[model samples]
Target: MPEKNSSSQLIEPEDALLEAFWTRAKNVAKINPLEVIVGLDSVSALRPSAYSLGDSSEEADRLCKLVMDGTKRATSSWVASYQAEDAPLPEVGELSIICDGSGTPHVLARTRKVTTVAFQEAGPEIAMAEGEGTFAQWKAEHDAFFRRECEELGIAFDPDGQVLTEYFEVLYSH
Candidate 1:
C-alpha cells in the first residue's frame, strides 16, 4: 500500500483502511449528524493524524492509559524542533487518532485550543492538564527533555524557547 507522509511518521490510508477506521470511529462516538450535529462532515475527508507517544512500548502504554483515563488532556513540544523536523503543528478543530504502543488507533482526539508560550511560561494549568505531577516537576522534566533532544540533534537549546502546546478533548475510543 502507498504511504502518506505526516508530521514525523507515515500513515498509509491505503484506500479504504483509513476510511473504514473513520466510519468505525464515528459509530463508536455515536455522532448523529442529522440530530446532534449540524456541520458534521462525511467520511470523504478523513484527515485525522495518527500518533503514538513515549520512547518505549511500555511508556507508550502508560501514556495511552493516562489519555484513556482523562488524566492527560494536553501535550507540549518545542516550536523550533517542530520547524526543523517540518512536522505539522496541531491546529484548532483538527482530529487526531491516538494510537497505542502497537500503533493501533484507540482514542480519537479533537483539538480544542492551542497556545504558544515561552518555556518559562508553562504554568500550573499546563502541568495539571499534562497529568505529569506538579508544575515544578513538569517544568524541570520538560527542560531536561528539550535540552536532551537538542543535544542529540546537535541543535542549541534556548531556555526561553517557544513551546507549542495543544489542549485537546477525547472524542471517542474503541
Candidate 2:
C-alpha cells in the first residue's frame, strides 16, 4: 500500500519509477544522486524543498513559475528521521525531481548547498533565498507551520530547533 502523508512521512514516486528516472538522470551526468521533492505545479513546476508548506495544485503552479523564471532558488526543511527510510541526506551536486502535491515529477534541479541552522536563526538571508517574504514573515509563518507539525508528532516546538536549508540550481523544466 502507498504510505500516508504525515509529517514524519515524505511522499515520493514509487520505487520502480524512481529507479527508472535515476537511469535517465545518470545519462545526463555521471553519478547523479537523484531525489524527489514536493513541488507546486502549474505552467511550469515550482519545486519546494520541503512538503510542510501546505502546497495545493494551484499554489504549486505559481511556485513552479517562480522557479522556472529563476526567481525562487532555494527551499528548506526540518529534518525528519522517516525520510531516511526512502533516501539519504541530501548532498551537494545531487539531482532532484520536483513533484507536485500529487507526486507528479515536473522539474529537475541540482543541489548547490545545504546548511543546518536553528529555527530562530532563519534570517533575512534565508528568507530572501526562499523568495517568500521578509525574515520576520518567514519566521512567523514557519513557526506556526512547525507548531502544527510538532503537535502532530507529539513533540514540543523548540525555538532553537534545527532546520536543513538547501540551495539548488534548476537544470530542467520537465
Candidate 3:
C-alpha cells in the first residue's frame, strides 16, 4: 500500500501491453462479437482517462480490490475538490480502468449511474449502496475524511455542499 496526495491519479497505458491485449481481444471478438467491447484497445480510449479511487495508497488499494470483487458498488466525494482537480465527473455508461494508489491499473469499471446530493443527504440509502457499513458509520467517517481533506486543501467543509456519487459495475478484472 502507498500513500497518495490525490483521490484519483491518471495512468497512461503502456502501448505494448495495449497492442497485445487488443490482438487477443480481436481474436475473441471474432467468436463472441457481442462480447468484444469496442474502444478497449488502448486504455486511453476507454474514457476521458483511467484513474485510481482514493486519496491514500492503502485505502485506494483496498477500495479498488473491493470494487473488483463486487463488494463495493458505489462511491462518493465532495464535489468542490473534485471540480478543483478538473477531473471529469463520472457519467453513466462510461468505461474506465481503476488503478491502485501506486498508479498501477488493476481493473476496469463501467459507470452505471451518477447522483449528486448534499452532505447532509448522505444517509442510509447511499450508505447501503456504498456497502461500507451502517449509515451512522458512513456519516461519521465521511465527515472526518472530508474535514481532513479540506484542511489539506485549505478549503472549508460545508455540510450542505454537494457530494458526487457514482455507481458502477466491474467490466474487467485483472
Clashes of each: 0, 7, 1
Best model per TM-score: 1
Model 1, span 84-134: residue lDDT tens: 777778888788877655566668888899999999877799989989789
Q: List, residue by residue over 1-174, the lDDT tens digit for candidate 3.
A: 234345553334454554454444434323233333563434333232456675566777888888877778988888887776676777887666676666666665667999998898766888887777799988998888888777777888888998888888765666
The worst-scoring run of ten residues by lDDT in candidate 3 lies at: 39-48
Candidate 1 overall Cα lDDT vs. reference?
Answer: 0.74
TM-scores of all predicted structures: 0.77, 0.65, 0.72
Off by over 4 Å in 1: 1-20, 30-44
TM-score of 2: 0.65
> How accurate locally, in lDDT, is each candidate?
0.74, 0.61, 0.68
Best by lDDT: 1
* All candidates in order of lDDT, best leading: 1, 3, 2
Q: Is candidate 1 or candidate 3 better by TM-score?
A: 1
